[model samples]
Target chain A: MYRYDEFDHAFVSARVEQFKDQVERRLAGELTEEQFRPLRLMNGVYLQLHAYMLRVAIPYGTLSGRQMHKLAHIARRYDRGYGHFTTRQNIQYNWPALSDMPAVLDELASVEMHALQTSGNCIRNVTADHFAGAAADEAADPRPYAEILRQWSSMHPEFSYLPRKFKIAVTGADRDRAAIQVHDIGLHLKKNEAGELGFAVYIGGGQGRTPMVAKKIRDFLPIEDLLTYTTAIVRVYNLNGRRDNKYKARIKILVHETGTEEITRQVETEWQAIKDTDLKMPQQDVDAIDNYFRMPNLPQRPEGWSQLAAARKADASFARWVDQNVTPHKNPDYGVVTISLKPIGGIPGDATDAQMDLVADIAEKFSNDEIRVSHEQNLVLPHVAIADLRIVYDLLLTDGLATANAGLITDIIACPGLDYCALANARSIPVAQRISERFGKPERQADIGELKIKISGCINACGHHHVGHIGILGVEKKGEELYQISLGGSGDEICTIGDITGRGFSSEEIVDAVETIVDRYLLVRTDKEENFLATYRRLGAAPFKDALYNETANAA
Target chain B: MSVKVLTANRLTDGEAVWLGANGDWLDHIDGALVARHAEAVAALEEAGKAAIKSNLVIDVNVIDVEERGTNLYPLRLRERIRQLGPTIRLDLGKQAEKTSANAA
Candidate 1:
């Protein structure tokens, strides 16, 4: 976790006070609702249907036990006794008071956190892989660059009032966990042919009304030119991005309109002017950041005689857990343990106050107290010793955090839809719960195998449905809630946007429709190893659509 | 059914407090300052202006304690700015002219 220095501390503290005054003015009628809207939004406050919602930034989804405890406290005292962790790794209090927001912000600043760019048309809280430093194949930690980008973009005078919101993602592993391909600017850290470290830049990827996978603007950019080039891209977007339609204000639209080649040329032209300037990273800065992410002292893998009695008789439960919850860690004995926030039939990405406390305690005891919130709505103990897995799992089980469904069909990603969000056309959480229940059986989920099911209440893509192997988008039909399914999208090493399968289904019919698709995959897949995505890719939406909609269509 | 409390940053001490519970909103406080023991208890009493409450929230509600706003001491900076009237509170001639133009 990055501690706030005086400069960072001072600015956030001052900004909180400024917002307090703004709130008072709005309350006292000194400022109109219109006048206070932007000011409040800048501070990550929004007026929803029922009450004010305060979005507090988690800063790349990294949190100390102390910070998590503080969030738990806020949930208990200020809002309802809980908080909602969002897709962007931020936490949102669905119901906060307009007047109390300043005080909330002040509390956030006290912990060196703020809601600064959680919302607004400006750059958002920069996101990276939840497993940034602790992943097995990491070439380097990407947080340092993310933090640097955060500082540079915090309130940059030029980019503050952009045409629309800008998002940037960075990754340093062979496998892209950061979903770098779907961001406005994606930086993949790689070793060039000459063995020099540099970035492969992709610009114009975004999700909205117009979804796009960013095109490669630069094949190789030296690390020193990272910020300079990023700035150039933003400058280009600001200069030429269409502000006429809110739907198409993203950089992706710009790239699509003026061809990626033209945008690349413009970015190159802009970069030529600033690449050698102050934006370049100092060697010391990079070294300093890299130092924070060095590998932990890990024990060597045991020289198993291939028959230590078949590994102590293989804990069947442990195998299931290891298969799902545990990810590849750099060290043989260490693994990236995903603390499942989704219990069977439970809402996605939600942790109770007690569960949070338990997680904090576990982090302190076995995992060094460093916890991360994933964009997929799961908490991760990025570096957990293999021997300590059972204990962590047992503790998690007691807290309803131990559902052995990490990437399985039951591990869903859903946004707070009509249940909480004023912007949603339908409720997303209940639908997710229904589907999870239908596929809640461990055997059923295991049989289904490696699936990404994402549900979004609206087109904002908060649930990241556009990138799910199976995407469910809930919309309103007349006054009823309807869901549309898309398939073949992914947010991993090889990213692709999902294509819509067919017509929408009603709220009640949606779950059955989803089950229909899952069953189709089970029947048609080459083997269990082939995921829903692979199957969808091998045989396009035609087959899955035919299976899911044929009967209902025939009836119609 | 969930309720979210809206706290404010008190100018006096730069901390957070429940509006009516921690302090009072004076309809007619013409005297000195008084201290209250428990803010949670005081909030139940007639304290300050309220915005909204008692609504639909199905998901888990988070109150990140780290975000409890600064240590509110309650000095009301807005009222102070208004009462002082920006270095020209006693200028009755200008006020009269401004008031008269409005009347006209």
Candidate 2:
């Protein structure tokens, strides 16, 4: 929870006023669409299919109760009473009118939030592990560094107009919940042997038409040289990245063309010159940012252990929910509760205005006013006491938020494909919905185990389909929707791009096709203990591909 | 040649609309002015450009359509989804309004 100082408040307010003036000019026909497009995109406003979309950044997916309440208010007032939480840990309003964008931004600025850099060719919202502060296994909270990077990159003159949109992710844990491997720059925060914090830096990773796992450029970059080293890497790409073709514009393409060793050498050379400059972070500045994120004082709640056991014993439903949706917190007395946005047959990552309001209330009362938007498209109550789990669960159940299917087959991640996106070739929501419903049964899903099904509308990979245990990509072919399935992909410590199974399936055949892979996986897996990803890795694509296409091939 | 119609999202609100026979934008594609021949298609394209210049619309295009019975259907799924709201959410877009209108 980084509070905005006077400078931060003034900066955001100034941007809002500037955007308001621009909006007025555009509405008055003083500027053409072409002239206004880039300006609007910089402010996170885009002309989507049915209406304009406003993407608000939730920096490192952190939010306060007041900010969440304000978001709900905006959704109720300016939008259609709901917002879609995207894979990048941002929230997008689908039906905000272009005329109302200025007012909407004004409301956002009131909270310590804005839509700046959510779109455009600037460094996008820097994402980190959702369980940054609360996770049991983290080396250090990554958000402090993320905030530092945010401060450094916000309106930075040199890197603003890169060849393409850039994304950076950080994770303090070895688990890689932030999907750092698929971003333009991935930073793994860790403590070396001497107990001094540093980062293992990976560069040129991206997911789009061409999905690439980032190359580890630096094994241990000192924490003091974070900004200077990052500038060096981005400087190298900015100079050499292709602007000739938009498809070939990302740093991943440049990295592919230039060998990793040469690129690393270039970055190190650049870093040597600038590492001693003002970009070098001082110890006091790092501590200043870290001070903002210090953990809340928690009096030992020893009674919660017995209380939680009693609650679990009383309700089988609650027991199942706790098993699935809750994860271990840094403090033994507390548990991190994931509010499943993916209800059976419901839209993934969508929270209605009422639902958002309810979550705010729950956060304020029980969870110390902290809420997190997971990159997996779920909300997190990061510091709920183990004893208060039942109460939080009950409040969430009232709003249909307590589905208890985290990391299960039904816990899907999807992009707003043809439904809202003008860039989409086919619909992703319906396909996700159908698959969720097919695997809706809890026992069935538990039997299938931890299977991630990520769907993208197009090859942009906004849905992170490239890293799904079972990835479904929808494309347009001969005026009809065709879904191409890719299996064995994962976004973890051992990140790997999925391999396509075979020919694509039509919309009608897609759900069944997914079911075929799951069923095949069930048959091949040694036991229930082995997850879909583990099974897929153990036995390659041959079995799944045979399950998906062999019957059709034989019939033909 | 397949039938065609000029369409765009209104500049102010970004609501999807189509050019009607009366040189006005209609919210629903049912009332859109269809171009059967090359001359009519050219006319529609000109109207689209004029609409953009007038700041009435953005992202103007002439998309293919076919008449099935009295209903107009877009040839491409993208345009079809645009003409009607998202297929997944029946309660959203123009389809919901149309349903309510028919019910009334």
Candidate 3:
């Protein structure tokens, strides 16, 4: 909903012109492939296994109907008729030409979007809750602050060439759909006892080779010092971060090596100088950005929409949808509808161009023409009128986008593994497909309840396997694809790295192994309401680990 | 064969630079000559070498590179680095292109 102002438009246009020139040099033979790789990657372009992959940033996972349609168009025209929505809420095209990138970027800019900061060791896309302003538990909309941060960091004078890439996430709501804990810097907006706005900051959180939950560095930072404090934290890492070894270069490692207390001191020392400077939020600027994120004016509910409920009260299928797919809204009459891109047995986040267009049309007609990209790789219609639920559901149904399992077992997150990615050591998409097929039943998924299953091709954790309630990491053992499972990993405010359950499994048995773990939890757990995460936390991995590796139970 | 109007943005200065006729980058822009933008021209030359070796060269011919629009010196430098194998030391063979041409 944030329209690009003149300044924003000018800035993007300038970037486009510059890239177009670079492309020409590349084609003309002045720029060699080696010379241009980082330059291209900074714009979110990658030469994958078979084709050039271009990742376009869907910042904070929000999009308008027009932008969605444009993406659909790009998919049909340039790519293989679809785009894969990544675990980070970005859309990646697998078949873009090196020559066509500048053109693709120009089109994106027309929609007020670009691939800037999507990759290359810079502060990557600033992700946020899909239900930012509309969620019932939201303290305040985090997007205005996010947008301010975005502009400040875009082509920032310093900190661009850091040791490694950085990721930041913000969530205003009590429930963390943005997965704030796993980000490099996670900010949770909160109103203190005195009703003043502040942020609960988490640092040193990531899901790559080393997975760790962020340590809380600041309990509640005042609103005035948000950017200054964040800049300080980044600056401390930038100046002292390990550049000798690429693997240990992340700020997460720095925090881990030097402890959170020392890191906090360093950040505070850096902040003392810049706190009152231009980084401080100007009233007019904050107000201007905040205006774009303001809630839509909706009238009071036409009484008994909830009572209208389900025509067939016993229709458990419909009830399942209402329970899982729908989220409560700040406004009574409106509900945030999560359209699951993960139809059972379909690729985790790959949406067909037709499906994208259909969703765009639905957003424009039924919802408020606004769509959101959840970090879990699902689509959100944040302002759907409760009265038109059935109509929207029917439309979503035709497109195979109407799966009600939003947080349920079936909404798995998986990366484009060896199938597309050059960095992967083993296959991920196939393993995910295997799991999807195994747990294809909607009723089965609903019974298992809200379980987060994530798979990464390798340790990069693009699939966010580090945060999954049941995490699966695909690795290679003697040239054969194997999976290593981790239990109790979470991505909420209280984040935790999953403990490895035991030895790896062959690809053939991995999916079944995962299902066995879930089924065992279902049988032994106390009640139906207790989710996988809750059960795991109460008892730790003993029960689940024994159930899987103990030869007698394993045979069964 | 191309159908769309494309735009490119530079990551460093966030300024517009012309794609060189030689297939890499150019120091001249608008009415500004390479001599006028001396620092930028030199940086582009360095980047040109890096870009040439960044990935498998594509869309443009690898041979007859000057006509294809890429720098010859960087191509030679990339080969030298490959020979040395991950040793960050710069191969003196790299600067031979500029020196040889200047000497001639």
Candidate 4:
């Protein structure tokens, strides 16, 4: 974890104080709601359906145990005893008083965290693969470059208020766990044939009303030009992006409206103008940032941890949990444990105050004092020793954090739809809850295999429903809530926006529709190993569509 | 004519509050000032403006409601959640508050 220098401390403290003054002015009737809307938004405060939401950034989804503890404290002290982890790797406190925001921000600053770019039109939180440095297939840790980009974009004058929000994601591995394809700018860090570090840059990808997979703008951008090239891309969009309509404002819309070749030409021209300037970081600065993300020292592991194997053999539930929630680490001795936030019949991505505190304790005691928030809305102990897995599992189990369903049917990603969002047309949480309970059986979920079920209340796609293996979008139809299902979507290396299967189903009919589709896939799949996504891709959405709408199947 | 009620989140605490007959904000929806006619809507809006001026609440707006006999119910599902609480957690929000009060 990177420690904040004196400059960082001073800068954050000043911003907190400034926000405090602004909030005071707003509360004292010095500023109207219209005047204060942008000011509050810039500080990550949103006025939702019934209350306010405060979104806190977890840069690259990395946090220390101490920071996690502080987050728990915030949830306990300021919020409604819980926080919702979002798809962008941020945590949103759904209820916070306007007067208390400055104090909350001050507490966050103490942990070297701020909500600054979390909600603004500026470059939002720079995210990377949750298993950034720990994944087995990573070519290089993407966080160093992410951190550099974070530093460069924080309060950058030129790009602060673009046509709309801009997002950037980076991945170190060929397996795109960071969902780089669905970002405004997606950087794939790789070593070229000559062993030189560079990025395969993709631009103008986004998921919203109009979803797009990023186009490859530059095949191999040299490491030195990372900042300069990124600036060029944003500059092109900032100047040319449409301001006439808010819906047509995102960079992805610009790329879609303007031909990719012409946009590439414009970006190249802009890059040529700025490549030699101070935006290009020197070698020493890059090296300094890279050192902060280096793997922590851990003692070498014994060949096989017999105790872990024995525990698995002893307890079938523990074995199921390990199989579902744990991923292989880059270091063979250690394991990355995902703490499922999705409990059956519970709100997805929500961790209670007590659970947060307990997870923080577990991180401190057994997992090298580091924690990560995955984009899938689960928490990760990225460097837990395999030998300590049982105890860590036990601790999480005691607090209801150890749900044995990760990447399974129950690990749902959902936005706070009509439940909390002012913009939502219908409810999402109840639908997700129903789905989780329907597939609550560990054996059943394991049989279903790695299925991604993402739901959103509206077309904003905050839940990344556009990329779900089974995407459910809630829409209002004739004063009733209807769920529109899309299949064959994926946010991976094989990035594709899902195609809508057919007519939407009523809320009552949706869960059954999902189950019907799942059942059809189960019967149609060659083997259980072929997951829902793989089966859908292989056979296409026709079978699944037929299963839902066919009167004969419904009768049966 | 369709009936309506003015609702807003309290500025200080962000609790869901509704305009009352006495020109006050009430936490529970049962005591809300339901306006059956257009004139009553004007009165509720006037009270809402005063509340805003007093910094009592933010984002004040009217929502459609149905008056069944004497009891009132919100028409839109979103407003119902606001009046009650999160559908997922019955034990957590205003619904719990109402339940506990009735139990007592």
Candidate 5:
């Protein structure tokens, strides 16, 4: 948890006042919609179907209990009693009034949070692994680097007005939980044989109308040159990326049009010139940022091992939850607990104001005062003691947050589709709901095992359908919602764009189509141990495609 | 010809509203002014522009509707959702308010 220094406090307070003035001017009819839209968007406000939506950033998916409580307060006061946690680890309030935005921002600033780069053609909220510092296999904590990038890129004069919105993700672990491969810039923090910290830099990875796996431009860049190398890549894209078509404006499109080799060469040439500049991070500065993220003091809790074993033995439901939602932590006694936002047939990633408050309370009391919003649209208690798992689980169960299907079929990722988004051609939440209900059984979900079903309303791919193990993209065909299924897509270490199965399914047929794919994988998988992704990779898209289209063909 | 209705989100609160026959914005689309012919459609579009200029609304558009019995139903799903709120959450949006109002 990085506390806001006097500078950060002053800077955020100033921005809030500035936005407040701008809002007043707009409401007073001093600025037209065209003139005010970009300003509103810069403050993370967007006019949606029914009302304005506000996106609040959670830098590197990290939050303190106080900040979580503040988010709950915002939901209760300014919005409908809930907020949607997005795939990029940001929370969006769907029904905030335009008149309430200034006050909402002021409230956020009080909590050391701002919606600044959550939108617009600038470096957006830099995401990192949800389990960054606590994960067992991490090389080093990536948030320190992410924080450094946030400091450097926040209102960076040179990169603010790039061709399109840019996203960067960093992961310290080899597991790639942050989905670094699918971002504009993906930094893999690691140490070389000489024990010097550096990064494996990836460029031009994005998911939209065109999905691209980032090309690894540098084998290893010294940690000191993080900002310099980043500036070089962005500068190259900012200069050459197409501004003619909004669709072709992302760095991913530029990387596609210009060959990877040439783009890498251009970035390298630019880097060579700026390598010795002030952009190079000094060691003391890095250490200063790193100091903010030092691991929390955890005295040995030896009694927790025996207590956890006893608790697991007493309750099968608790055991199931622990098995599904808990992952190993750096400390043997501690575990990273994922609080499932996806209950049976519930909206994915939505938490009620009460739930948010409850989570905040639990985080403060049981876990360290830390909470994380995972990119999978779940919340994380990064340092919950194994001994305290039962108490936390019970509190969560009261609010229907203790679903034992973390990586299962029901743990879906869905975007706010035609339901709320003016840009959406079809509805995504309903499709996700139907699929979750269809496969809501715990035993069934366990049997299916680790299948990600991500849904997007349109090709904007906000739901990240391109990376779902079973991706369902909703598109309007002939005035009806048609869901296009893509199999074998994954946003992981070995990332690949999903293959489109065949003719899309109508809204009525989509759930059955997804079931058919799951059932087909179940039938064809080598064993229960083989997940849907492994089976899909093993036997390409043909079998699942047959199951989807052949069944439709027979029905027709 | 398909009937048309002028719709926009109110600038102050961003509540979805439809242009009424009395030259006023109505939160519910039931009382919206319908345009069945080219001339009326032109009038509706003009009103939308006027509303935008007046700074009363944003994202103004004239959407196609089908006259079903005595009611107007939007042709596009997006517009329908806008009128009725999100389909997924029946407890939310205009649909819930309408339900409660009718019940009352």
Candidate 6:
């Protein structure tokens, strides 16, 4: 994990002090709500439906044991006894008192964590694949570059107040776990024919009222030019992005309106002016960052294989968890263990303070004290010994974290819908919960195969519902809460927005509708290996649409 | 024909609060002052002034409510959810506390 230096410490502490003063002034009635709203928002404070929500950035989803413990402490001491890990790999405390926000931030700063740039129309927290360093297929760890971007984008004077909130996702792996194709600026760290590091840039992708897959602006951008290239992109966006309408203010809108060819021309023009200036990253600095992210001296444990195999053979459920939750690591002895936050019939992404502390303890013990928060709303022990997998599973099971539902139907991504959000038109968690319960059977989930069900309570698509294989969007019609089902949305290398199959269903009917769609997928699939997205793509929406609307209606 | 009540999240703690008949902000939705037509507008104005003077809440607005027997209920599902905790987790937030308290 990256440690904060003196400059980073000073910058965060000063920011906390500034926000402290702002909160004090607002509480003392010196600053009115109109005056305080933006200031509070800049510090990641949002006035939600029931409480002031404090969103703390978990930079690149990397966490130390100490930092994780502090988060648990904050959840217990300052706000509600739990926190929600969002799709952006950040944790949100749903019930923090406005008066106590400064203190909360102070606690965050102590652990090199902060709420800065987690929100607002600025570069939000840069997200990466949770298994950054450990993933077997990765050419490089993306965290260092993400950290570099975080430093550059933190309070960037020019881009602070942009056309709209900008999001950047970086991934070093080929499978694109970071969902790079759905970001405003997606950087894929790759190598040239000479084995020189560079980025494959995808720009203009976003999910909201209007969802679009990003188009590639640059197939190969030299790694040394990361900063200059990014600056050029933002500068072009700042100059040309829409500001007249908030709805059409994102860079995706600009890319859609201006056409990729024109935008590329503008970015290139801007890049020519500033590519070789002070903005260019020195090769030495890049090497130093690479050194910081050097693979730890994990002594080779060849015995782990036999030990793990023995344990798997001993316990059937442990074997199942190993199959589902444990991902292959670059090291044969090590495995990336995904700790599922989605307990069966429980709220997705929610971790109570006790559960968080337990995870921290486990991370400290077995994962080299390093934890990663996945964008899918789960925690990851990025490097756990294969031999220690069973022990970790047992510990996680005690805290309800070992659901063995990674990539399973129960592992649903849901936004804080009408439950806590001020803008949500419908409740997302209840629908997710009902679906989870309906398909809670392990045998059924395994039979159904890999399915992604994403739910967003509103059109903002915070849940990335647009990219779900089975997307559920909540909308209000005729004073009733209804859910619209969309099929075949994906956020992987092949990015596509789900198509609305039919009319909306009432909250009571949405889960059954989802089951119907999944059941149809299971029936019509070429093989068990054919996942929901592939099956949907092959058959198109006609079959799923028939199952959802026509057959359901006929049955009704 | 819509009965309404003024509500806001308290500025200090961001808890949901309702404008009471005695011009005080109460945590409970049942204590909210119900009004019709002109009274609703005046109540909202009063709520705004209270919000400014006390710095008690932010985003003050009127929500439609209806009388269901002796108790008043918010008409829209959004407002109803705001008044209660998340419908999914019945054991959490203020709704659970309220339920346990009522049971006691």
TM-score of each: 0.82, 0.99, 0.84, 0.98, 0.99, 0.98
Better of 2 and 3 by DockQ: 2
4 or 5, greater by DockQ: 5
Regions more than 4 Å wrong, model 4 = A553-556
**Which candidate do you rate higher for DockQ, 3 or 5?**
5
To one decimal, what is the Cα RMSD in angstroms of model 4 from the true structure?
A: 1.4
Please give the distance, in angstroms, between residue A215's alpha carbon in candidate 3 and its true position after superposition: 1.5
In model 2 chain A, the worst 10-residue window by lDDT is: A547-556
User: Which numbered prediction scores highest in DockQ against the true structure?
Assistant: 2
In model 6, how many backbone clashes occur? 1
Clashes found in each candidate (C-alpha, N, C closer than 3 A):
29, 0, 40, 0, 0, 1
Q: Is candidate 5 or candidate 6 better by lDDT?
A: 5
lDDT of 6 by residue, B1-104 (tens): 56888888888888888888888888888877888778667867776776767787788888889888767788898788778867766776679889999999
lDDT for model 6 comes to 0.90
TM-score of chain A of 5: 0.99
Tens digits of lDDT, candidate 5, A44-120 = 99989999999999999999999999999999999889999999899999999989999999999999999999989
Task: Give the total clashing residue pairs for model 4.
Answer: 0
DockQ, per model, reads 0.02, 0.88, 0.03, 0.67, 0.87, 0.83
lDDT of 1 by residue, B31-98 (tens): 21233334632443323223211111111111111212332221332222222211111232122334
| Model 1 ranges off by over 4 Å | A296-315, A552-556, B1-104
Q: Which ranges in model 2 have alpha carbons more than 4 Å from their true place? A: A552-556
- For candidate 1 chain A, which ten residues in a row score worst on lDDT? A303-312
TM-score of the second chain for every model: 0.23, 0.96, 0.22, 0.92, 0.96, 0.86
As a whole number from 0 to 100, the lDDT of residue A477 in candidate 5 is: 85
lDDT of 1 by residue, A1-556 (tens): 5777789999998898898888787666677555767998899876543346788888778887877877877777677566777888988875466656777787777778889998888988999889988887877778888888898999899999999999998888879988988999998888888888888899889776678898987888888888899999999999999999988889999999999888889989999998889888998987776665566555554442232224436766656776788887776667789988777888798776777778888887777678898988999998787767767877887867878899888899999876556577777888888888999998888988889899998988889999999898988776577899999999886889999988999988999998888888888999988888888889999878888768778567
Ranking by DockQ: 2, 5, 6, 4, 3, 1
Error of 4 at A36 (Å): 1.3
- In order, the first chain's TM-score in every candidate is 0.95, 0.99, 0.97, 0.98, 0.99, 0.99
